[model samples]
Target: MKNILHVFRHDLRRATSNVMAVIVLFGLVVIPSLFTWFNVIASWNPFENTKNLTVAVANTDEGYQSDLVPIRLNVGEQVLSALRANNDLNWVITSEDEAIDGTKSGEYYAAIVLPPTFSADMMTFYSNGSEHTKIEYYTNEKKNALAPKITEQGAGEVSTSINEVFTEKLSEVALNIITSLSGYLDDADTQATLSRLQARVSGVAAQLRAASTTADMFTSLIASSRPLVDSASGLVSTSGDALQDATGALGTGKDAAQSLKDVLTSTTVALGDARSGTADSYQAVADSVDDVFSSMNAQSASSADALGAAATRVQTQIDQHQQLRDTLVNDVRPLLPESAVDSFDRAVSRIDASIARQQDLHDRLDHAATHITDTDADVQAMHAEITGLIANAKASVDDAQSAYTGSLQPKLDALAETLSVIGGDVDSIGSDLSSVAESLSGSDSLTTALEHAESLTTDISSTLTETADRFDALANALTKAMDTGDLSELTEVIGADPQALATHLAEPVSLKRVPVYSVVSFGAAMTPLYTVLALWVGALLISVSIRVDPPQGAASDLPVLTPTQTYLGRFGIFALVGFLQSSLVCLGSVLFTQVQPEHPFLLILTGWVMSLVFTLIVYTFVVTFGNAGKALAVLMLVVQISTSGGAYPLQVLPQWFQNISPFLPATHAVNAMRSAIAGIYQNDFWVSLGLLAAFALPALLLGLVLRLPLIGFNQKLLRALASTKLM
Candidate 1:
């Protein structure tokens, strides 16, 4: 261990004297120090407390003509005014050419140019619906970073202002158009046109009203005529009933007369037979005459009974007619006019009187017929007795027959003529009923015609009412159209101009002035890592210098030191020297550059840890492959520097490069250091520390293992001599 320390001290002293080693150390310390300074300067707040930002504007738009005003403000002027009014910025208006030159030369950060036909194009956009006359901004891209961004924002603001003005103007124009339309509609000519329309509507309405009124009158007339029609219809029905009743009575009378005629004929035939049989057998004739008289009497009695029944039926008919007459006068008559009622009453009375007369005639006829039948029966019996008595005296029988035939035949013929006259009277009454029925039928036809006319009138009234309702709707629609007055007003209430409205509400933009600052050049962020790399290269050179020296004399055969002490001595000396080099670099940055670290102690500590890790790595490789290990260290340095995203973020590198970036110690160191400098708190600092520890601890242990055989006094002198030539 004593010899190893002695060898370590000898190697360190020789390393300090070598020109290449000193030069390598200086390059490592100075180059990274400058890079770190530049990075710190680049990251400083350039825009802090920046004020009075200058902005450029160019407006070339011509004024517009309005109906009420000769000239109106152009869109460009409106944009300019809006920018000037903004409290966030100070706007400077310049000609288009001047603004452009000033922006490019960094005199002005941003420039805006309003198109030549801005107002005219906008009007054309409104009138012809074209998209033209876009607002444009010119900005200096390289001067200050914020300048272009501010210019972009400013151009947006100007566009917004122009849109707002255009929108407001358009709204005013719409309102004015509405007002103009209202005036035009209220003028005499338009009002006259409306009046003509109203007159036409009113005329149609009047016609409808008249038709309605006429319908009402027709309905009233129908109401008034209904009673008369009803009465006529009732009279027709009643007359028909009366005629049917009279026809039925006539049928009954005819049937009874025919039966009575048959009975009378049968009686006459029996009487004649009895009279003829008396001469053939006087006694037998007398008996047959008695039978004949009995038969004749029965038949005559039946005929008389039939005549009585006919008379009673006629009497009943007369009573029914009288009742009908009374009912017509008391109940049905008042329902008709006085003349018609009286006429019906008279007809009923006449029918009743006729029925009474017929009844009397039938009664007289029946009584006379009954008397004649009884007389005939007596004569038949007497004739029969006389014929029997005369048959005994045969010469007087013919004379008796002549006397009986002459008297009975004349009375029977007179009865037959009376029955025929009564039947004729029944026929005449039936004819009268038929005439009344025909008159009632004619009245019914007239009543039906009146009902048809009433229905037609109702249909006409309904049609007229529908017409009036349609006219009312037309008038209301016309009134609403007149009240609205303007098409533009309708368009606005209905979301007609969506794009213009959207443009109007957007935020106004102005040119943004970016404060100028010194920018760090490319690859400046990786300066500290590069410096650490240069330090490792310088350490390798020193290690080679110590190893290549010639051996001293026959060395003491002291046992080799343990791998731990031998590796520790090499690792410790390099670690301390690398740390001293990193400290010098950080000190140079603070002194020469205006780089102020937020946490100076932590920054220094991080640098020290990085140096130790690099030292262990250099020692491990050097012990493993001797002088050839220097080439591996250089390769590692290249990989670390390339992978570390210091100058450009790792994201900007190719994908494969980004994949291997975490394994590079330089990458971890750069990220951790940037986090500290930028006040970006992150867990990556500890992680980076751990990764560096892994590299440093393992390299130190491995170097110890590899150096175990060379730990003795003589072996250390020989290893030092070998390291010197390799440097």
Candidate 2:
């Protein structure tokens, strides 16, 4: 440590003793301050002076109007107004061609263009809800990157302002349309519908009043039909009873037919007996024919006359029976059902056969009588003929009896069966009619209910007719209202104040800027870079005039100081000059004068550390290689200034620069100072401070650790250069 102090004081005395060295040291103080304050004052806050940068604007929007919406849209004019009002960007309005050329020529950072169809596209959106109007934005990337970026942001703001105004105007139009619809639909507007509506109400009332009257009328009509239906039911009942009586009468008729059959049977038997007697008498007469002829000779004519009369009488009786049979057939046959008519015919046929046989006998008698009369004239003339005639009559009588017995009883049985069937059918009919009558009697309530239903139908029909009239009135009323354009009240509901609406739409959001690291101005925010550069460059100047180590030819013969002592002594001298440079730059660069740092003491501390580390780096390099080493130190200063994150963030630099940014001492120095000035202690703050401190280690190690070899190599090179007369 004493050796280091001894060398440090000796070098300090030597520097002051030389007038040129003293002047160089004084220049060091002035130069670093000049580097920091002069540049900082020149480009202090570029963004705040952006009004100097011109951005071209071209608006060729042909204004459009829509008849469907009674409004004209002039969006380009609105944008111009907004642009003129805004001071954020210097917008130069020009023709499309000029704006395009200006942007291409780099005269403007960016250009904004409104197409000729801008308002037409907007009109299309309002007319049929289609299409979007696009604002053209052209940027010059060929220009510096920051100006174009800032100009693009300004262009976006212009578009947003115009769109807000467009939306506000469009909403007003839509609101008015809705209001017009409301007015058109207002129903209270005077119309013919009022009278029609009243008429409909009157018709409905009239129908309601007639409902009971129509019902009662139906009741009366139904009541009148009940008696006629009852009469029909009664008539059917009487017909059934009459059929029953007719059935009883037919039973009596059957009994009478049986009686007649029996009587006919008895008569037939009598006729048989008479036929036998006649046959016997005829035989007797033949035997006594001679004797009888003599006895009847005198009365023969009278006898003939009597026989003729008997024959006539028999003929007359047969005619009477036939007439009676005809009367019975024509009258009584019709009285029975057709099934019994055949029985009546069979009975009458039997009677006709019997009577026919009787007629034959009578004819025979007449002939015999005539013969007798003739025989009187000629005695014993026709006795045999008369006998033969008598025999024939008897035979006929027997045949008549046979015919009556054969057919009459069978016919009577048939007539009896027919009468029995007729009687049963009549009884069944009577029973059925009685049942029908009872059913009709039980249906009295059904008739009343049916009558009520008919009454209701008439009432409903009347109601429907009245309702139809009402509906007609309603339809007429609706048509009248529509023709007059009357509907409801909504016109005043959806209205807006234009100014208020525009204000609301214009800037819907506001920005509240809260800086984590507060800097008074953009210039102040960048103070760390200037101060750090000044500190580092001060170190390079200190190495120039001051001999960093002993001359190589003389270094071998000098007092035996250790390599670390040699390094510390030289670094100590550079440190004095570096700190002195830091003080002047920090004071002049607005470290506390133009801008108040959050940590003024820490900023001074940062500057001091940066100077110390930078001086060590240069001092070690110059000591190791003499004049060549000084050249290397200046080269390092150039590399660090370009690659360091002090001027621009390392992130924005080329990748190769970023790869080495962390290793640069100036990068760490600037970061540390930035933390101090801005009052933001980010991790980079401590990391950068630690890195700056760490850089001191390598400078120290090279100055002390490999010091013997480096000094030997530097001395040898120095001698070689001196020998060539280059020093």
User: What is the RMSD of candidate 2?
Assistant: 32.9
Which sections of candidate 2 miss by over 4 Å?
104-109, 123-132, 138-145, 172-496, 551-562, 590-593, 651-659, 682-687
Top-TM-score structure, candidate number: 2
Candidate 1 residue-wise lDDT, 380-488, digit = tens? 5544443443343222323322332354334434545655676687678667767766666676677778888888888888888887766665455445546665445
Task: Name the candidate that leads on lDDT.
Answer: 2
lDDT of 2: 0.68
- lDDT accuracy of residue 136 in candidate 1: 74
- How big is the positional error of residue 553 in model 2, measured in Å on the Cα after superposition? 11
Q: What is the C-alpha lDDT of each candidate?
A: 0.59, 0.68
